[model samples]
Structure formats: structure tokens, C-alpha cells
Target: MSSRISGPGLGSRSARRAAAVTPLLLAVLLSGCSSGGSGGTKASSAPSPRTESTATATAPASPDAAAYRRWGIDKPLAAPPAPPSAKLTDGLKPGAAPKVIRRVPTSDKVVFLTFDDGAEKDPEFVKMTKDLKLPFTMFLTDDIARAGTGYGYFEQLRGEGNRNSINNHTLSHPNLRTLSADAQRREICGQQDVLEKRYGGKPPLFRPPYGNYNDATLAAAGGCGVKALLLWEATMQINDMRYAQGDQLRPGDIVLAHFRGPSELKGTTMTKMVANMLRSIERQGFTVARLEDYV
Candidate 1:
């Protein structure tokens, strides 16, 4: 999750100069936005396939009117600051290949579901996952874990029988493109280490925060043993809430949702968000399926 600071605090000529330089740097960072990377074939170390899908989503309502409003998301109590470690790197190196994963995509009846930032274990999510026997993938970040909302709460959900898998999302959620090569590896590999210690083994897939990453990010990811860098095909928002993708989403599409939020409107709990998504998908003539079926 990215942070937004409103109003003016830091200012003056130096601030303006710093701000002026940001866009030029941002251009470099944004260059990673392309679905294809340099030379296509996963850059030397053989980075995994990083396919992305884009959709036109109307920005949901701001979080301010959430309390009295029924259709908007509740604004985050305070604007979040950019994650503390969003630095950029220029060095590059190859890493290990993560385990090859398989999905049930050929069925044309199922879809994969992925959630980013396991900020907390929303009971509604646990209940829904259990009740529906849904399979959802979590791309975890240590900061979220350190924030006290780690995966410990969902031990049972991650057990052998459960269809959920916890993957690495980076120790600190940085825009991988912005960091130096070594720093990029540290972010990716460091999180993999964290996942291994906490989840009993390291994750095979890596997804950058906010879908952000550059070739350096991918190269570093490959060095860290990640076979595939996952991306989403679509995200659902209803009554201004986000949802678990597969619950009511469809086949071949990657569904994206979040663990916490700077809500589109206030009072928008995880419960309402998931509900909204399910309703939206069902209305679209498709159902959400576990990504395992796809690839």
C-alpha cells in the first residue's frame, strides 16, 4: 500500500527543486509499468512470467464521508506515509528459480484469487474462506507482520489442507524499480527469508507492492528463487469495498484485493468489501476461482 500526505508541511525553494526532480525519477520508475520487460524472456536469470491486466476503474469515493454514508468507503483515520523504505537501486544480479506452480485455468470455470499486504487477519475473511472453502493466495510483507496483523492468526487456514498459500511481498514494501540492484535483492530475498522463518518455508512467488517493480526487481527476484512474478487481471470494488477475487470472480482472470485499506469511503470494513466483490462478480456472469487452476 502507498501513502498519501495531504496539506502543506515541508516547503520552500529546495522542496520545489526536490519535487521537480521527482518526475524525472518517476519516469524511470514508471517505465516498469509495461507488462513486457527488456527482451521478453524473463531477463537473463530467467525471471518468471509477469503478465498484467489493466482495467478502467473509477476512483472510488474518498474516505471522508464514510461514517454517515452507506455507499462510500471509510477514509483511513489518517493519511498513510509512503512506506519508510522506498529507495531505488541500479545494480543487477541473477537469483534462483522458485518452484514451478500449476493452476486450474483450462477449466474455463475457475479463477485465481490473490490478496496483497496481509496487514491483518479479518475474521470476516477467515469465516468466508472457511465457509466457502475458497482458495486465496496472500503476498505478505514483513511490515504488516510487524504491524501485529501477521499470518499467525490464520494458522489453520494455511495448514496442509487449506488451499491458501502465503508468498513474499518484500520485507518493506518498496517500489522495486526505485531501489539499487543490491537493495532490490535485499528487499526480495529478505522477505523470502522472513516468510521461510514464519511460514515454515519460503514462498515461490513474489508480487511487488502496488504492482510495482522493474527489470532490476525481476532479476533480483530470480536470484531469490522466485519462478513467477504474479500480477492481477482485475480488481473488484462494490459499494466502495474490495473483495477476495475467486469467491465470485472467474477463470483465467487474476483477482486482486487487499488486507487493509485507506478505504474509498469510511466505515468500509473488510466484510463489506468482500461482499461487494462477490455481488459484483456474480452479476458479471462469472465466479472467482483459485489461481492454482490457471498456471
Candidate 2:
């Protein structure tokens, strides 16, 4: 959830200098979510939240230069509307990037619970998963997903029959958007290759570090056999000492949480967050579903 994803043009003097001074930005974003069930494990150290944002920003600037020049126009491209829901597919075609899985269930009240950047699996989280029987989506990073580490935790989740998945968050958690074409391929495809080998199945989905991406970022993701660009519709943030996700949670909302920072991990401690999230969902009279099942 909170890891760095490197991209090109992010290593220059200006970028490095900016990076050094960018901690303040993280402080601003993380300070509010540092405690309670709201923080969770994906809540990496404060100021390091740039992990995903920096990577997603690596795309070549002036993406529409040629097109604009052709039309003798010079203005920023409009923000594209949300993509429609679609089925997941495998393999990459030339110039194709990952397609956005806008929301798993557009009509159901069910919520897709997702955790990112699992530093390690916590027994507490696992227990809660078993107790609640909540299905979740884990966007795994290479560090904890490796053999002899958090791998067993992943297996445990599957053994418990938790409706969840392990998708690529990138091998080193570098922001693929910031990397060069080669680096993007390395981060995207490289992680896919590793997860396939280590996890026994490659993920068909990807989440750019920090939910940040542009046209080029999406293209790169698609080129690597990633079909779905996963993003959240809502986030649980601290309201005083408790976590809140809007006035009333709804059906079909993708709620984001974390399990890779100072306070929590996937196995146990992270369960508190999931428990709270599940309770919220139940309160809304909606059930939790596997992202794959719905998407």
C-alpha cells in the first residue's frame, strides 16, 4: 500500500531534490491515518506515501504532442471518464495497456475490500479473516510475497477459503509510471513473471503504486498482460480514533485499506481493520464478495 514504485525522469537532480523535500506531502496525507483501525499495515511510514505517486508520474510528458501538433492545438487532454466494467482476460497485445475494472458490482450493495503492500502476514489478521469469512483483494509486493517469508500466509488465506486474491503491486514496489519503457516493462512484467513462478499463478490485475496513472501508465500496464487497473471507490480514514468511510457506506463501492506499515500486517493485526470494514458492510446490509467472482 505504501511502497515506492520508481519510474523514469524521477532520478534527475530536480526530481531527487524534489523527492527529498516531498516528505512533507506524505506527512500531510498520512498524518491523519496514522492510528486506530484506519491505519492498518499498508500504512507505511509517513512521508513515504510517494511510493506509488512517483512511479505513476514517470510517463513521458507531452503524451499528446504529436496529436495536438497534428491539429495545431496545445492544451491538456481531458480527464477520461470512468471505464465500464468488463471481464478479465490474459496475455498482452502490442500497444494494449491494462483496462480499468471500474467497480466489481455496479448494482449490488457488496463491497470489494482490498489491502495493499503486505509487509508480512499477521496471524491476527488471518484469524479475523476466518472469523468473518470476508473475501479480500491483496495487491502483493515482491518483498513479502517471496518464498520463506509471507508466502505461507498467502497459502493460509487460501486454505481458510477466504475469497481473496494476490495481485501484483510490482516486484520492488516502484511506481511503474515514472520508469522508462524498459523499466516499466521490468516492474510490470517482471513482477508478473515472479508472482507466476512464486505464487503459482500470475495475476491478471495490477494497481499502479498509489492508484496513480496516466494514459502511458495504463498502456504500460496493458502491455504486460495486466488486464484490469484496480482502483478504490472509497477509503477508510480516521475519524478521530475510529475509521470512517463516508456518512453511510454503499453497495458496489471498492474500499481501500493497507497492511504493510508500522502498525499492521496481513495475518492478524490487519484483521481489526478488516473486521471493522466488514461490520460497516453488514450494517449497510451488503455482503463482501471476491473481486474475481464479481468482476
Residues 1-295 of candidate 1 have per-residue lDDT tens digits of 1111111111001001111233332232212211211111222222223221111111112234333133322222222121111111102223533322212223354445676666546666665555444456777677765555445755545523445677777877766667898998998999888776765555666776656556677677777767566665455443422222333334455565556432321446666666665555555555554443233
Lowest-sum lDDT 10-residue window in model 1: 10-19
What's the number of clashes in each of the models?
Answer: 37, 35
Residue ranges of candidate 2 with Cα displaced over 4 Å: 1-95, 160-162, 238-246, 260-268
What C-alpha lDDT, on a 0 to 100 scale, does residue 236 get in candidate 1? 40
Q: For residues 137-245, could you state the per-residue lDDT of candidate 2 as single tens digits?
A: 7777666465344567775664233346677777666645567777777777887887777655567667766555556666666766665666665564322112234
State the displacement of the C-alpha of residue 263, model 2, in Å, after optimal TM-score superposition. 3.4
Worst 10 residues of 2 by lDDT: 10-19
Q: Report the lDDT of model 2 for residue 283.
A: 51
Q: In candidate 1, residue 220 scores what lDDT?
A: 77
Best by TM-score: 2
